[model samples]
Target: MERKLFLKNGLAALGLAAIAPLANACKKDTSGSDTTDTSGTTTTGGNSSTTCTVSPTETEGPFPTKTPGSLVRSNIVGDRTGVAFTIKIYIKNKNSSCAALSGALVDIWHCDKDGYYSEYGGTSMQTVDYTSNHFLRGRQVTDSNGLVTFTSIFPGWYTSRATHIHVHVYNSSGTSLLVTQIAFPEGSSSAVTLVNTTGSSYGYTKGMSGYTYNASDNVFSDDTAALETAVVSGSLSGGYTLTHTINVSA
Candidate 1:
């Protein structure tokens, strides 16, 4: 099946639910070694040390620009405001024994503190107008280590979806490879809660209350544990840094 079609059907198979608190508490430990299973699927995190498997394919949401080449850069925060955040992603090719894939274009975009995307006008829930705004949207080419980093603010929560970021990876020649979203773990380990609740001017309007958890999001329900990013917080006054390794086919 086509990638987009597969993700659409996958979303349908996992029925959507009303926004609610997560039932399972997120674990604090986010470190683990990689090891390959008998099925050739590499698993990361938790107690297991296994070979890394291909990152799960996900839907390219409606908001992605029809032409994504124009938005290439290291910094994506155009003119937004919120707690400072740094995101680092490592790109590896599972088809080549989990080798690092350099020079790959990694595109990332997310909602602002008020849960509104850039370059698109405000939605019914978001009242601010941003028809020409382009915050939180940019692309970075992976370095020799297959690493791409972005400096921005921690994303805010919306109605049905959990706190997340959308990512799309393309080869040097611009062939789309992977389309996926990174989810923040729920509960005390949640970077979303730490930044929003304690700070007086962090700019996260919703905080954690009334927000959908990773366990409740249809797109992540299938494997919330595997997809959750490892988050490290400095101080509410400072900001947070998130890191995740993305494995994909060459």
Candidate 2:
């Protein structure tokens, strides 16, 4: 799609929720450091020769924020409730030896604590009608460090897929570069398990009984998860902070 068209459109309409045929309800990390495939990261001077691997693009389907440009802020929690979540994304330029890609447009959106999305809803995949709502969605421009952070709630799970976040990166010129998703950590000690386990207070109703694991997710099942997952830290009571690195060839 054209860059101008994408920005001008804003979240005016909601994409159809992918249900039934959805490969995975949801078929859907690491920490400070980038994936092993990337040689290294830039230093404080921002002049180091960091060669990051080009991350594979993923589908932006089911639901993508219609007008991301309209919602530009660090705190995207709009009337939604759940465990506080902080998302940090670092975008690097693989084509330019992995230098920090400053001024890049980084937009992210995810489901609420109850497996519902804003703007468009009421589909088989999503029963609630949130067509007029706009939560858990925002856009920001990467700073000198090629980083943009967003404040939201720890996303809840749906069927067929694992808990994940959708990210669309655009160049400084607003040209779409990569559209990918960030998977969360699993296991008993991981935040994903803790948040889902406690539903009464947090509003996370589904729990983990029928939850989908990353291994069986249709999107990340292709083995690209190594680079797609984020390194999450913190707690169920204290909230969680996620840091992920996205490498783009542009």
Candidate 3:
């Protein structure tokens, strides 16, 4: 895990100066109010902190398409019902002083509330047909501020794995830059717990039962803290928001 640096003509250095305007534009809120967390920290979206450490790369798992264009779009929820969840990812180039990487393709996919993935079926635990169902899978291109958003349901857990979301970043030409995963904080938050237990009427079925936590997940055990996302906000009934910054070597 040696830190890699970017040269003057490297990908990170390209269009580095154009990100500020994009970031500012994305922050323009009609309500003129910042998003406040339970800790009273107000932030624009969810990237208020300044940590430039590169996110550890993780396996893309066995589900992602080997090539692009399988199912590319911004909103991936696709008729699946569960706790409403929105994920915001900020992409930065660590080699370029963590400059925001504009126009990068951010791809994300995860299992539905019942621990079944879309576009694939007949796995050991997943007997339902999903070859035509593309829920919980989508891609968004980074804006000028290096931000991409995905509208998805709260990911459900399957056997031998923790609650997590898979992310892949690529340049505009589809050159893969980073492959990693974002994990939820161990133990359900006040918002998540309610959805798991009493939100069954709202399409929640995981309920944190027989679930594997981050500490035990092999891919995340090396450094779970770094891979975990900030505590989620809002309730399952009203939808939730989770955000994290991803630093990658360009």
Candidate 4:
């Protein structure tokens, strides 16, 4: 009889132990009910990253990337040949109508008189000693009055794009707020021929197509005519005068 009583008591103890684990599991579920899904998975907390989008007009103008070089280069006609030409860029916050934008940064790059651009990887652009950094390209910061100047050559015309300089403006924060290519007006036949010959040597497929206007450029369709002026005064042996005004919208 004692043996039977011991067996019955052991059975009851085993059953109670199993019941205890079940009760604990139920308690845990109830405590976290608010966080668990029907599939028993815990809900995610707010720990993910997100991206912010901003429109172009809301940003300010660019800050200077480099100090203005004190080198007083010439803006003369004689500088366009094997020599490098210099240009003074005027930065403005507003267009010709007079809007005020301060602290604009201007970045400029142009091809050399030989129709070669720096970083294009060719011997024709520079001299054998590589001293001719002929493609005059540089950046400047607009003062409180909005002006930046650079020393560059009279860019020879390319097949599709005419003789032009590319300018990119950004706000202080490095945001690209504006992009425009400045172009030169059509000159005498000799000037046109020079551009065509140099451009052909550089593998340009198309010849100059009657100096396209601002309305014709695919990228700068909305740019103002006054902003796209071409200043040409003379040749590398002589000198030339070309002035362009860029008007930016507020």
TM-score of each: 0.78, 0.80, 0.76, 0.48
Backbone N/Cα/C clashes per model: 9, 18, 0, 21
Which has the better TM-score: candidate 1, or candidate 3? 1
lDDT of 3 by residue, 108-137 (tens): 888877767777765433456777777788
- For model 1 the local lDDT of residue 50 reads 30
- TM-score, ranked from best to worst: 2, 1, 3, 4
Q: How far does residue 108 in candidate 2 sit from its true spot (Å)?
A: 0.3
Candidate numbers sorted by lDDT from highest down: 2, 1, 3, 4
Candidate 1, residues 106-213, lDDT tens digits: the string is: 999998877677766544323456767778988899999899999988787665576778889999998989888887644443455565565447666455565655
What tens-digit string does per-residue lDDT give for candidate 2 at 136-175?
A: 9999999999999999999986655678899999997889
- Best TM-score among the predictions, by candidate number: 2
Error of 3 at 88 (Å): 0.7
What lDDT does the true structure give each of the candidates? 0.66, 0.72, 0.64, 0.39
Kindly provide the TM-score of model 2 when superposed on the true structure, using C-alpha atoms.
0.80
Candidate 4: list runs displaced more than 4 Å: 1-84, 95-97, 122-135, 189-227, 234-238
Name the runs in model 3 displaced over 4 angstroms. Answer: 1-49, 188-190
Model 4 weakest lDDT span, ten residues long: 1-10
Off by over 4 Å in 2: 1-51
For each candidate, C-alpha RMSD in Å? 8.2, 8.7, 13.3, 30.9
Candidate 1: regions farther than 4 A off: 1-50, 122-127
> How far off is residue 123 in model 1, in Å?
5.4
